[model samples]
Target chain A: MALLIAVAADDSLREQNVGQSLQERVPGAATVDIHGLYRAHWRYLVRLAVLLVDDTPSAEDVVQDAFIALHRRSGSLRDPDAALAYLRASVVNLSRSVLRRRQVARKHLKVAEPQTVAPADDSVLVRDEHRATLVAVRALPRHQREVLVLRYWSGLSEREIAQTLGISNGAVKSAASRGIATLHRVLGGAPDA
Target chain B: MRDGMGPDDIERQLRDSFDARARAGVPDGAMPPPPRFATAGAAPRRHGRWLAPLAAAAVVLAVVGTVLGLQSGSGHHGQQPVAGPSGRQTSPPVLQTSATAAPVDIRMVPVDGATYGVGMPVVAYFSQRFSSAKPLVAATSVTVSGKPVHAAWYFEKSAKPGYPVEGHLRMRDYWPAHVDVHVTVAANAITPATTVNFHTGARTIAVVEDAKHQMVVTSDDKSLGVFPVSLGTDSTPTGRGTKVIMAKQPSICLSGPGFHGCGIKYAQQLTFSGEYLIAAPWNAALGLRDTSNGCTNLTSADAEYLYRHLRVGDVVKYPDTTGPMMQVAGGLGDWNVPWAVWLKGGLIPTG
Candidate 1:
């Protein structure tokens, strides 16, 4: 019991020091050190947004908006400890908006015929195959795609995924299974284990 | 089954096919996750009838492409997202000219500004009209030594049609120290073609210790005053290091993500560092929050001063504050108090 307490105390001290050190480097940054905070997590945020938006540029925009929001609300972040949580929430919210925008655009924006097309050849065949897979993935319901991206690409633990997305563990698993099943149907039976 | 494939076999094939498609730049719609799949709901796409066969074909072709190992040497060339003239905000990559046109009288107007956070606008005003409706400029396909760059255009609707058109460029994050932007506008068009030389100056000339931590300025030089400002919490540290000043905007809309701001055409920003060109709000409730995406949260006035004076290539650095030993090295890293002292004293010691 003593050892456990000692270890816990040490970890707590380390964390406190990290916070303090950050605060010292960027005084008053305990809560509002958006720069340092972004350095650590922006890549992950961008990566996450990329999956959500499925477009690098749009994902970047989404993440940028999230950071801007953090800056705007820096004062209101009551617990310095929960800054990451706030950021995650903000990013998810922003991504949702992007999705909404895309849906809206799709509904109204009547695009013309594709101006460019791949030339016919073996490469074209491969391109078509890739295009097919993309279409299939896009076909999956938004929830399924989200579940798959978080679980597989983002490599989040089920629990973490649950917390970030605000869902039960059971829901995450079910979503994953269903998504996988649909993907399976699309790919013409599993090729490997 | 068409080929007597089992469910497990099908699932694996699908996953592989999907992943393969992603690698091909086919826009597999896959993103890195910590997914909000639940709250956001499952993949909301309504697959049309034609999707299945196309996907199957895609899988077959991808497998063949893999085996042939003929990596298409050609990179993915995505079509510009076409937006209409009036309602569309996204700017297609500006057209570039390789051939130099007859030397038309070109006026150089350098406007500098900064942002409070990422994706904020950086606008610039031209005193006179652009000479070209389609002035010839060097290619827009330029990248700084370190980071890739992106540009967005916002026309000054209020400006006279023939006069100088106000232009705004929102630079990305973590840019190299030196970035040169080339833009050319037709003599008659409202938008003007302008060339800018952006430099991310060296970091830290002074240290202002405040309630949170230290703020470092790059040089005693008055031409450009680049300060090192901390962003949000360390766990979510905003992008740091040096970037070059690009365009300048008088005002911008901060309607997206973590923060919001407007009417900020202060502080000339680095070309491509972390995507914060906006200024952070001075709300004490935010804990003197260094909560920007690597943008220095300047008082609007200070931002204005920097905006007017600072040129590009002014380096911005945030020395690691674990200790006080500070040193001015090219790369972004930690600095101690001694280093801070040395910097403050104007001693340029090699890191």
Candidate 2:
């Protein structure tokens, strides 16, 4: 059953990539080997999506959609080597879409059942310490979360994060600082080193 | 003593939490199914037979001119391209490419939208080994209840091959009950920028008695209930000290040396080692008889009530038992360990 799910996900990603490759045009630009690129980067991209969405199924969908979007515009890129950058940007944008949709659904659910607690199936089994840390991370503001995730989780440089999010490098730095400071305060202060 | 955690510590904790969660959520395997889209780019090619030869001649002239220019050293723009085994010119150095590959995979512990016990901490993990921790520490941030937290980051060294180094974050104290926590790591600082949100649930604690054969429950220090229970036999004593509720089930089948296909209802597992549970036994009278192996038997009504109210990470203290203290990592029983011992078990080295 797990294997089947994985295969289905892989196929979905490839189909999106193929669909995208056919849509966008870059006149006289070199055509990238979309298959090779997909093979190499699909897992990594999905992991990125998982961090953003916090679920495997949604993360897979997010990454697949990003590849398809990249494929559509792959031909128009001024530099063919910039394909990875484009994919990363697409993934981030699509993940936002997923989160926005989830927020809407949650709002509706809240309206329908104001007093009900969240279902238990929504959480994964992990250590209490880890769970607390994640809670703190999730509580950060959207921009700050993006910057922190990109900086620490993705290991992207400040400039690269700025480019991906279409923000200034200085903004990235400040957002990150504020975000970390917020985390420290929210987590009840860091332990003595 | 103040926890003067610098950027490096925060970076490490973030990396550890993210990596651990990502590892759990995403399976390592082949990609998923392909997407469906219209074949929009399949247009007929224009016939350009005459231009083919001209294009080849232009390419040949350009290659000759480039070689001559390189020999003269005047037209060499940057690092000279070397000839490969196939006799083709290698491409020039890519200036725009980053020095270190971005961390494409990440895992955050507790996951997004998860409700956790107040003792939980925020952790993040990345797939890339960090050479410089400055940018990561500067760019990543965490907050709880609209307020920032002073979180320490610890670099977690990986034990398995192919697994990337991890980062872990923790607060000096446990989380406040019923508060939301937010984490933000800037885009490109890790992979792509992202945010995580999770909320802490109510606070709960359990007091168990092996000598009196009873238990008491409390929420936020207010007494909730007191019920009778049956503890372990003399030979197979129940584990003493504090243990965290690791999981719960509506019903569980009891099997092992002292039992005969007996079923337990409303089972709440107290130990991480899976040896002990606080549950209602098949026979209600067992609640007053100390005949079980290692489990604590309770009445059906009380078991169901406690099971419904208890949350993972709630403390279950065996205050009156002579058994050994729960081991750290033996389950979620970190509370059983001494303060100094607990600090030593941290992923980060402390002063």
Candidate 3:
């Protein structure tokens, strides 16, 4: 408990003058790269969002909103490294709101459980074991999918994941434990304990 | 590394199939039409589902000063209806017992006037285990800001003998901020009878987004401030979890890796493994890069401000980062253990 850490923070400021270069970055993300990165990562993000939101159009909307939020928040970012993460987190949050909106919309419409997402003809669907797995993954609760997808897709650490999902680390661990358990069973890889 | 237990194969397929399907669905240049320019000001989200840590105990040893053996155990077992705090909230009730009256003192971790965060637990320390916790358990009661809470007792497993057996207690959820916790333990027999009190300060929680190098502090659904920080480096990564402030020090010496220095100011300890939030004016890349041994490195000015404003038991959460997960027993990590599991107690059994 007594092993004191020798590391310090202001040391970097003295040795390397990185702040001046950071100023150049603040204005850049606000204009050029917001559009550039949005266009570049749009397809990838839409695809990822679709897995959780369960459709392409809604997923696209979620990504767009996320990009716009990122643009607004980018000024505070000193390092460009945080840009993608901020985008990923925004998407996750926006996806939750979309899900909540759908639940309300469904209740208002008195329609089916809002499952008209998968395209039918030449449906972006491929029939195979992976499809079955994907179906099961999608069918799982949205929060669980958020945990699994963020963990598996974006490769975020549990800490970053909690920030992204606005949940606790313990909740993250619990969701992962339960999600992984269900996936093992769904894929016929493991039986009940 | 996935802490505790996280399987690899299932996670790999989740990625593999996701990547394949995404590529198959969207061919070259098939991006959706650019979104409308309006609606950029995203509505602020109200985090009603904000899950916080268990109550942080700031008065672990203060009870020892007033620990007095109340009386011999009548052996009612585990369910002891404690005598309510007599003369509730008039003048501080002065117990009529000597500190050394009992062989083993029943100490409440309720520091008389210290304030902690919402997640602070109401803890009791037994110098030695009674035949059962009943004698001590029944003699204890807790009220938060004058409202009675049916707080139950969960005994803890000491790391070793002579380390004081603990009876941990908390409400169903994290405590609300700006409340006072009055814990009265009348250990009539096992050891001493003492009533100690502690305050729950603001429900302050700091979430450190590692990638962003931003530490955001919030209290009661309001944003307090955002400070730039440089977290631990790859070699000595900062472990992640919902951690509580265990202590504060004005100045301390810290040495890790290639550096060794003293006069480091405004140190607030997070974990027992030497993780801290401290002043590190030496790092040029305060928010640009990870540089410290494992502590959260902040500017000296920020550190001093936080040291003064933040109290022991205030929560600081680190989402999954490059580091490992924190262990429940590592420091004031009781909050990391799920509530249901926490209810089951540790070492000592309820059933």
Candidate 4:
């Protein structure tokens, strides 16, 4: 089930009563406080950003920037239920911008270096094949890569991915299918008879 | 590693892969400190609004100062000073032209900071068509990792009659992966000064042999793997030379003259014409004797392995061929054309 976190401006009566049913269902999941929201979602959001941007420092920066933006705009969002969605969207958008900026920096900056893939002990974490999969996924087109990562990594359903990407449900489905097909081909998997 | 698995199995493997990578990367730790946010109902901070205008005034003063300095420095010339439209005595027209030859407005194709496939050609668009390209070519240089490479500028005409012309620079071969390209367009007789930088990601090259019926794959010059393959028949020979992997498909049905619903698996395109591919025959043994409509056929396993590893920028070279090599415009066929021939492809007219 998706988590809904309300970010209200203050602990006023109007804010309290805004989503009584959702509040009871999730039990204080809605947070009017930015710090509280950050404390709650920072880790997961950072991981998500890491998957998208492929680096921890940039990922953390992206997540932190997302929170700062959210905090600044918390007063404007009437529906507190949209807070988590806003954060997710912001993270994705910021990640794209980071990649774009990185691309430009790479072109002009002499200090630019290719991102080194951290070598992990195979016995402790990923198999060679799994790591290969990750590399292949990184090389996919942006839309296809985003859809695949959201669907498989985050376990978000097609509908959720569609909402997160602001694309249609059909687009999500096609992207997922295409991404999977590409992955299968890359991974040396045989087609179904 | 089982056969007949469907998309669901692939999805499960992908999920497992992503989870494993995440587990290795994200550590279990306390949440990092968040940026300071405005307290409950505090107004957001606003900086000075007049800073922009102040900066503009400073720039104007600097430009005027430089122009006046130039005029004074040229005052000793015996020629009479020219009168300006505003009735002020200005520097000679020649000196003014030298000072105000608007720095060539240069826009590099790929812009600054674009990641292109290995087949990308560095193109520079000039605001005006250059009368001579020798100065521009002499001043410009393309380097990889601070080391220079053989690159030449070809003048490409504007698509529309009156549109500005462009100079396209290309190396002799496809770019190696993960290398930074530094482009310096120095201020020269034909164009103004500009610098462009770009990067190529992960170099994957596949060499195919029709006579030997083998395909070798390499990443960053290290051999990843090799596989036996079937090449096109005598009637339909695969074109030779270099091609970039354009696209991939898991399975596609081939249909045309003299062909039925013949299926190919793990198909990666090599030509922009969509005519040739490196794929495996559907439901057939991979190493079977050559029989294709000008495509290199691989085993399903090999095809999938390549599909997983090869990206859009990766190069595929056909060293042995029964037919002529493809043209430069045929799918990233930049490597097929020789450096001298490629140099002539640009807009500069030969004397």
- After superposing candidate 4 on the true structure, give the runs of residues whose Cα lies further than 4 Å from its correct spot: A1-193, B1-120, B123-132, B147-149, B154-168, B172-177, B186-196, B201-203, B246-267, B275-278, B281-285, B340-347
After aligning candidate 1 to the native by TM-score, how far in Å is the CA of B298 from where it should be?
A: 53
Mind giving the per-residue lDDT tens digits that candidate 3 earns over A1-193? 1111111111111111121211111224533456446544666677677766765556666776777677667667655457767777777777777777777767767665545333432123332444655777877777788898888766779999998888999999999888888886776543211
Candidate 2 vs. true structure, TM-score: 0.41
| TM-scores for candidates 1 onward, in order | 0.33, 0.41, 0.46, 0.39
Question: How big a share of the true inter-chain contacts is recovered in candidate 4?
Answer: 0.21
Better of 2 and 4 by DockQ: 4
Candidate 3 regions with alpha-carbon error over 4 angstroms? A1-193, B1-57, B61-103, B107-110, B159-161, B188-191
Q: Model 1: per-residue lDDT, tens digit, B238-304?
A: 4433333323344543221222344544534332122334444453323255554334466555556
Q: How well is each residue in B1-351 modelled by candidate 2, as lDDT tens digits?
A: 655556555655666566545544543322222221111232111111101111100000000112222224322344222211122122332212133433333322223455656654343333234444545555567788999986554444331112233344445655678888777766543345556677777777678877777788778878988888787766656778877665455655443231323356676666533344555545454536566656777777777788778755566789877655665434444455445544443433433
Model 2 regions lying over 4 Å from their true place? A1-193, B1-104, B108-111, B121-140, B152-170, B185-195, B258-263, B275-278, B283-290, B337-351
Model 2 chain B: ten consecutive residues of lowest lDDT: B54-63
Better of 1 and 4 by DockQ: 4
Which regions of candidate 1 fall more than 4 Å away from where they truly are? Answer: A1-32, A78-81, A111-133, A190-193, B1-351
Which of 2 and 4 is the better model by lDDT?
4
lDDT by residue for model 4 (B194-304), tens: 676767867777788666677788777789887887766665667888876644555654432233243566666665334445565452534545666567777667777
Q: In candidate 2, how many Å is residue B224 off?
A: 0.9
**lDDT for each candidate structure:** 0.37, 0.53, 0.59, 0.55
